[model samples]
Target chain A: MDAAIRFHGVGKSFKKKRVLDNISFSIPKGEVYGILGENGAGKSTMLKMMANLCLPDQGGIEVLGQKPSWELYQKIAYLSDRAKWYSDYTVEEALQYGKNFYPDFQMDRAEELVEFFKLDRRLLGKEMSKGQEARLQFLLCFSRDVELMLLDEPFSGIDLITREKMIELIIESIMERKLTLVITTHEIDEVEGLLNRVSFVKDTKIVVEGEVEELRLKSGSLKELYREVYA
Target chain B: METRVVGSYRFILDFSQPIYEQLVQQFRQMLAKGEIELGSKLPSVRDFAVQMKINPSTVVRAYQELERDGLCEKRRGQGTFITSSADQVAGLRREMAENALESFVEVLKILGVTQEEAQKMIAGVEWK
Candidate 1:
């Protein structure tokens, strides 16, 4: 049981406002881990630290058994909460960008996903709806053969059908490969079945963290636990 | 028979309980009731995971429990299959019946019903 990501007493601050305080946890390889919390509870900050998108003010973070580096970035796919595509690029061009930039990107899988998600190749990024944009972003990230995937608020502002499709793709990816996924989302019930483990962050620290099934057996459903912890 | 086998396993999972335990219980009950045909191949771990929309590890756990209980066997390079032995099936059926009766009696005790009253109720039931 090797760890795919580890955070040791990590802390972060933005303009003197402390967001995360002394966070510590580790996600095992091939496990689907969820970082659950309300908005601005430092869930996204933890994901950013793993992706090397932000620097921690204290302590250290390790990914794939090493410090996060440019070389390691190639092995990790980080999908941001605010994913913005090149407005001028067509759907086909957007996928081509992923192929050219990510050496691990599979064109065949991308093409298959494009059809599965029902995206029009000729449609421009600016012309697509919110749900369609989310689909495109997810497919782009999912087409890569990365070892660790960091998804921040993947289901926010998306339609129900699109969210279900994303969940299906997540399960399929887990089955097909040895992938460790770290996702932050408010929609806990939707991904409850997919998460092997979860950590609930509140007031800049993890209030609860353990195997989802064990926690559920002791307390209740994750949704009920979420209410008890955050409500 | 193939359709029946596939149709019987469409489980609407309840997350309040341990998911793997629920899967194991369902399979155990189905095997005891002769619902699942012996020698039929179960879905592969990967396929079952996708079909059930659950983690593959959960499916593996349930399948391992089934194998350990002698209700199923996994052949190398082949999928898991239900036990073809009538003796094993009969054993499971008897064990399941005993478990059910024990639970019923326990509930009756909790309700403060005497054994004589329980026997009378059982006798009053109309068997199909």
Candidate 2:
């Protein structure tokens, strides 16, 4: 299987504080892969590097078979934990913005996702609740026909019902588009079943990575391995 | 379905499947049997994890699976509770069991266990 994302000797640091250390891994195409870690374990930092939002201090990174750069930006959608929107823009405007940046953006699919997520197209981005904003961001991300998606904490601030809907939407998109997703989240339980594989991050490094069932059989549970690694 | 309070435990899980699916199926079955009692507190995610000696995430996955099937609801700051539509649990159980049985029988056959021997082995189990 072709790799959607690959990191080689990837290292990052901020103001002398190391975040990611000698990280190396590959996420195969058409798989829902997870980056599991506790808060401040550099989960989001690694995702940022993969999304090309930030450059690694050392080593190489690839997204969609190419070096992380502006050229491949449209082929990948990165949703950070802190999703921002123009206060004056409506849901339709956000979709349009996405279309402008991403050549593969699907307008009809955006509309369908908005409807499915129950977001009002007329509601201004600023007027939306936290949950609604998360849902709207999710809708926009899903609407983009990207080859790889990097979502950093997509479930934060969302209600359980909305989270479930978002997960189902993701599953459907993964099946239909054969998209590869690398998600970082604290809500491991919510995404456990959906993940085909998991990469456990600890001490600013990837300690374990493999098929979910294989790890589950060995560690007896994802949570167990997480505790053993991070605790 | 009737729930019997055996010993100090409020309920029992009678499925002869893998522990993970058994945990999920039994929880749903408890709700269907009214043993969970709507509004009654189910086990905590951590408590269940310790009891099963598995990861809390696995317990959480099981609960999330149950929630997705609409057999349970999780309230923020409160524990999960049985849903009113517990009858749906029966359909889910049948579907899951059928899938598991298919794989189980296939594996048994692959391991050189004849259908008759499998049946005999299954019948030899002493049920209380």
DockQ of each: 0.65, 0.04
TM-score (0 to 1) for chain A, all models?
0.98, 0.96
Q: For model 2, what is the alpha-carbon lDDT of residue A139?
A: 85
Instruction: Please list the Cα RMSD from the true structure of every candidate, rounded to 1 decimal place.
Output: 3.1, 12.5
Runs off by more than 4 Å, candidate 2: B1-128
Q: If you assessed candidate 2 against the hidden native complex, which CAPRI class would it receive?
A: incorrect
lDDT of 1 by residue, A33-97 (tens): 99999999999999988988888999999999999888888889999857685578888999999
Question: Mind giving the per-residue lDDT tens digits that candidate 2 earns over A1-231?
Answer: 699989999999999899999999999988788999989999999888887789998999988888988778767888975758546899888888888977888998998888898888888989988788888888888888778899998987688888767776776675466788889987766765567788988888999999876776677566667778877
Which candidate gets the maximum lDDT versus the true structure?
1
Q: What's the DockQ of model 1?
A: 0.65
Clashing pairs in 1: none
**TM-score of only chain B in every candidate structure:** 0.88, 0.53
| CA displacement after TM-score superposition, residue B18 of candidate 2 (Å) | 8.6
Q: iRMS of each prediction in angstroms?
A: 1.2, 10.4
Tell me the lDDT of candidate 1.
Answer: 0.88
